[model samples]
Target: MTSIALIEAAAQRLAGPARRTPLLSSPFLDEIAGRRVLVKPECLQHTGSFKFRGGWSAVSALDPEVRARGVIAFSSGNHAQGVAAAAKGHGVPSVIIMPSDAPQLKIANTRALGAEVVLYDRANEDRDALGAKLAGERGLTLIKPFDEPQVIAGQGTTGLEIAEQAAEEGVSRADVLVCCGGGGLTSGIALALEAKAPGLRARPVEPEGFDDVARSLAAGLIQRNPRLSGSICDAIITPQPGDITFPIMQRLCGPGLAVSEEEALRAMALAFLRLKIVIEPGGAVALAAALFRPEAVEGDAVIAVASGGNVDAGMFCEALERFGG
Candidate 1:
C-alpha cells in the first residue's frame, strides 16, 4: 500500500535527482477545451518521462547491498529508459527487457544509458518469467514497471508536486488527468491528490481499444484488453489494470475516460505547436481527453500529465504533418 508518508519519503529520496516538471498552459488548448487547461510536461523529465521519479525512488530506496547487485525491469519504452538511467546514475548495473516492436529510439536510449537491452516478443512471451529468470541468474533485483509499493509511492510524488503547483497556479479544484496503463501513475497520483489536494481529483485516461481501466471502473471488476499491441500509444498499453493499483483508483480516482488514437496524435501535435513540447501518443492521451473529451470532464479547469516523449522520428513527423495546424 502506498500512503502519503511513503510518497513523502520517496520525494525526499528524489529531492535533487528528479526534475520537478513544470505545469504549463496554452491559450490555444484552453480555447479548444472550452476551459483552462494546465499541462504537466513530464516529457521534460529525466529519461523523457515521469517514470524517472518512480525509477529513482525505487532504485535509490533499495538497501545499498541489494542495489549494488543491480536491477532489472520490463517496459515498452518509457519505464525501461527511466529505470536504466536511474540505475546508471546510481552506479549500478541494469538489464532492460523491452518488446521487440517498441520504438527504436527507446531501445537505443536504454542501451545508451548503459543498460543491457534484451528484446522480447510481447505477444508470445511473458516478461515476468523472463525478468525473474534474469534476476535469478544475475542476482539482480526485479523492479516491476508497476504493481509495486515502492514504485507507486515514487510515482505518487508527482501528485504531491501537482498539488503544490496547482495551488501556486490558484487551481484549487480541477480534474487531474493522468495517462493510464497498469494503473501505476494514475493510482499513485490519485492517492496523493486524495491526501494533499482533496479538491482536485485524479482521473485515468486511456486509448479507445485499450480502455480496460475505464471499463473495469465502470463494471466494478477487472477487465483485460483483447489484443496486446498495435496502437500508436504503445507506451501506455497494458493487458489490464494491476491488482494492487486498480482498487486504489477505484476508490480515490474519478471515472476513467478514454480517447481515440487519432485524438492522441492530435493532442500531440497541439502540444508541440502550442506548448512547444513533443509528447508521444500514449503520453498525449490525458491531453487528448482534456481537449477532445471536454464534456466528460468536470470543473472549469483541467490538468493533464504529458506522461512521456520517447517517440520515433517517423511517427512524430506523421503527427506534425497530419495535425500540426
Candidate 2:
C-alpha cells in the first residue's frame, strides 16, 4: 500500500514529465450505459500506458549512485516501455525481460526506448527468475512492476489527478472502474480515492477466466488465476494479485467485476469508434464493465480508466472490424 504523502511527492516529481490525461465523455456511451461516463485515456500517456508513472517514480527516486548501477525489470510491454523510457531519461541503463509472445509493437518500443530486451517463453520460462539472475549478476536494481511502494505511490498520482479533474467537471462522486491485473493500479488508486475523494469508489475490473482479484474479494483471501496465458487482455494477465497491493484493494475497493473477452474486445472497438481513442483489450475492461454491467455500479456517473493503448496494429484493426458487430 502507498501512503498519501508518497503519492503527493510522486505527483510533484511527475508534474513536469507525466501528462494529465483528459477525462473524456461521450453522449453515445452515456445513453448505452444509462449514466454519465467519464473516460481517463491513459492510452494517451507517455509510453502509451499508466505504467510510466510508476516507472518514472521508481527510477527517479533512486540515489544517483544506485541509479548509476542501472535497473532491471520484468514486464510484457507497458511496464517495459515505462522502465525503459524512465531509465533513458535518467541516463541509466535498463534491461527488460519480456515474454517471447508479447506483441511485437511493445517489444520494438521497449528496445526503441534504449533498453536491452531479453525475451523468454511465456509458457515454459520464468521471467522473475531471469530478471533476478540479471539483477544479481549486474548489480542492478530490480523495479518490480506493481509490488514496489514507489511504483504504487507513483500510480496513485493518477487517482489524485482524477479526483481533482472530476471535481472541476462538477462530479463530486463516481464509481471508478479500474482494470486490475496484480492490483497495483487499482490498489494505488483506491488509496488515493480514500484520501482525496471518499465518495468516488474504486472498483477492480478483470476478464472472465482471469478474475483472481474478483474471486479474492469474494472469498476474503488472496486468490490465484488457474492459468495465465489464455486471455486476450494480456496486459492485465498476472497469475495472482500482488502481495503489497491486495490488502489495500481488499480494504478500499468494492466487489470486483469480470468481463468476457468478447466484451473487452467490443469495448475496445467502441472506444476507437466513439471516443476516437485506441485502447488495448486489457485497458478496455473497466469501460466494458461500465457499458455491459452497469447495474453493479453505484451512482449515476462512472469513471472508467482506459489504462493503455499498446496493442499491435493487426489486433487493433481486428477488434475494430470484428468486435464492433
Candidate 3:
C-alpha cells in the first residue's frame, strides 16, 4: 500500500485509542515569524508522546500467536514507554531495554505498564544486541523502536491528524516541522502530509550535535555518527536515523535543520509559559527551528509537532532559566 494509505489505516485503527491532541495557535510565535504558527500538542497524548500512536499500531498488527508470546524493544526513553503501554493495552507482555542513564520517569512509567526493564550503559553497551538476545531467549516478538514499517506507519497517524486539522481550519498548505531522532516520527509525518496535503512541505528538525538525519539527507545516503554529543533534547539524540526511515525522509521531507541546545530550551520554555503546555526538549526542537531559522519557514503557515511532554522537574526548571523566562 502507499504510505498515505498506510497512514490512513493507522489513523483509523488508532482513533479510538490515541487522543486527538489540540492544534494550538501560538500568537507569540506567529508574531515572531510573521506568519501563522500552530503547534500539534502530542505532548497531551496518552503516555505523553506521539510514540503511543506508533506503538499501538505496531502491537495491534502483531500476529495473534506473536502477541501471545509477547514482544521486546530497546529505547532511550519515549519509545520504551510507548511499547510498554501499547503492549499492556493489548494484554501482551513486553520487555524493554533502556540505557542505564535514561530518565528515571521513563523507566518508572515503563515498569508501571508491567514491562520488564533491562538497563545497559549507553556509552559502553550495545542495547540492540541485549534486546535481541532477550527476545530470542524468551520467544518474544522483537519490535524495533523506529526502523520497522509498522512503526513508521503508526507514527504517520500524527501527520494524518495534523493535515486533517489544518484543512478543517482552512489552511491549504503549510510547512510541517517535526523533531527527528531515528527518523520514524519525521518520516511518518512526511508520508502522511505528502499524501493528505500534496503541496505541504515537511521539515525534520534535529539537535545541533545530533544531526545524523540532516547529514544523511545532504549526502543522499544513510550516515552514522560514531558518537552522539550532548543535547538538552536527549530523546532525539540518536546516533543515526534508521535505514528504512532515512530513505522515506530523503524522498518526502525538505532538507533537515539542526537547532542549538539553547534554542530548544527556549522553545520548551515558551510552550510552557506562553502556550501553557508542557513540552520536552525533543518535542520543542521543531519550534526552535521555526524561531531560530525563520527564513526556512517564512511566508508559510507552519505547524510544529510538539511530540512529547515527559520531562524531569529539575530539567524543566533549568530549561526555563536557560530560556530567560
Candidate 4:
C-alpha cells in the first residue's frame, strides 16, 4: 500500500527530475463551468504525461543492482513512454509491451525513447503473460502502470502539489477531479488529500462506456468494463479499478464522474483555446466533467488534472476541427 511517507520519499527522488506542473485557470473556462476551474496540466509534464513521475519513482526506488537489470511495463501508450524515458534517463534498459492498436505516435515515441517496443493484439493476446515472459528472459523488474506501490506513491506527488497550490490560491475546499483508468492517479490524489488537504476531495473521472471506476465507486465494489479497446479516450481505459487502488479510492474519493467521448474532445478543444495546451481525449475527461458536468461536482471551484498529451496529430486535429470554437 502507498502511504504519505512513501509519497514524500517518491517526491524526494523526483525533486530534480519531475516537473512541478502549474495550476492554471482562465475566465473563459470559468464561465463555461459556472465555477472557478483550475487545471493542473500534467500534459505539460515530462514524457507528455504525469505517468513519468510514477515510472521514474518506481525505477529509481529499485536497488541499484536491480535497476541495472532493466525494467518492463505494459501500457497502451502514456505509461509506456513514461517508463521508456525514465529507463533511458537512468541508463538502464526497458521493454514496453503495448497494444498494436495503440496510437502510433505513442509506439513511435516509446521506440525513440530507447526502449524495445513489443506490440500485441489487444483483443486476442494476454499482455501480462507476454510482459512476464519478457521480464523473466531479461531479468527485468516489472513496473506496473497503476498497481505497484512505488508507482502509486509517485502519482501521489501530484496530489501533494495540488494541496500546496490550492492553499496558495486560497482554495480551502474543492473537488480535485482526476482522469481515471486503473485508479492509480485518483487513489494517489485521494490519499494526499486525506493526509494534507482534508477540505479538498478527490474524484475520479472516466469516459462513458469505459467507466469502470465510476461504476465501481458507485457500487462500493470493484466492477469491470464490458469493452476496453473502442474508446477514443484510450489512455483511461482499463478492465477495472486496480485491487491495490480501489480501496484507497473508496476510503478517500468522492463519487466518480463519467463523460462522453465527445465531451472529452470538447474539453480538449477548450483547453487548447483557453489554456493554450494540448490535451489528449483521456486526459481531458476530468476537464470535461468540470466544464460540462458542473452539477455533479461540488464547491465554488474545481481542480482538474489534465493527465497526458501524447496524442496523434490526426486525432488532435479532429478534436480541434469539431469543437475548437
Q: Which candidate is the best by lDDT?
A: 4
- The digit string of per-residue lDDT tens for model 3 on 156-178 reads 88888888899987887778889
| C-alpha lDDT of candidate 2 relative to the true structure | 0.91
Better of 1 and 2 by lDDT: 1
lDDT of 4 by residue, 116-195 (tens): 99999979999889988988988999999999899999999999999999999999899999999998889888888899
lDDT of 2 by residue, 13-97 (tens): 8998899999998999999899999999999999999999999999988999999989999876789899999999889999999
**RMSD in order of candidates:** 1.6, 1.6, 1.8, 1.4
TM-score of each: 0.96, 0.96, 0.94, 0.96
Off by over 4 Å in 1: 99-104, 120-128
Poorest stretch of ten by lDDT in candidate 1? 101-110
Instruction: In candidate 4, list every pair of residues with a backbone clash.
Output: none
List clash counts for every candidate, in order. Answer: 0, 0, 0, 0
* Candidates' C-alpha lDDT: 0.92, 0.91, 0.84, 0.93
- List ranges where model 2 is wrong by over 4 Å: 121-126, 323-325
